[model samples]
Target: FQISLPSLKERVQDIPVLAKHFVAVFADKTNKAALEITDDYLAALKQYTWPGNIRELKNIIERSVILEEAGKLTTDTLPFEITHTQETGNLSSFDLALVEKQHIKKVLNYTKGNKTETARLLNIGLTTLYRKLEE
Candidate 1:
């Protein structure tokens, strides 16, 4: 009988078990018995949205195991976007636009709102920057 498992995002709660299984399989294949996952690491995995699901998780684990010097996995070992998502949740397009506006405002502030300098720093034309601010 062929039983197809659901995607990882559809079964995010299974990450820990899957991670453990992968670790065991990898450890056996590499003849490295000292490797083990930490609770913190698993928690981070659970918190992630896993847009790419199990395949992405598997690739990340494999990459981490291959590159990690120690047997332990830390949140730092995960990709930056994962951490960003965990901290900020998923940002909407409006949120992104706000961030960009804030950044432009900061740069302008630093230049004392000098359009020419702000545009130069931002690598945009003064007229374009003005138009953007108006929008």
Candidate 2:
């Protein structure tokens, strides 16, 4: 007998639960303490179409867990493709600079104004981060 499952996008509610489970599993594997996922992170996961289904979600969550530094899974750890595609309809402009500024602010908020960690999470040099802040 065969049983079929729905795509992750079709079951949006499950995204958070699955993400939490994956974070726990990966965190344990990496010998890290329990990690908590932020609501925004979960929202982003749910916003994605999940073309690769559950396996894709699992991979993304594992990647997030491994890359996480603040002991919490925030959208800063998510790939640009994923975070960039989320709810762009609400944006007033598609200009790269505006998007970058907004993204920097979001990461800063996630880091609780910790510029060093924000730069680290954004994968930019501390000097570059300050430069962007000046812009």
Q: TM-score of every model?
A: 0.57, 0.67
lDDT of 2 by residue, 1-135 (tens): 999988888999988788888888899999999998888898888888888999999999889988888799898888766776644643343568767987899789778999999999999999999999899
RMSD of each: 9.7, 4.8
Q: Which number leads on TM-score?
A: 2
Q: Among all windows of ten consecutive residues in candidate 1, which has the lowest summed lDDT?
A: 91-100
- Candidates' C-alpha lDDT: 0.73, 0.85
Global CA lDDT of candidate 2, please? 0.85
Clashing pairs in 1: none
Tens-digit per-residue lDDT, 1-135, candidate 1: 899978777786789989887777766666666576877778778878787887788877776566555677665456555545655667442366555666687678667779899999999988889887987
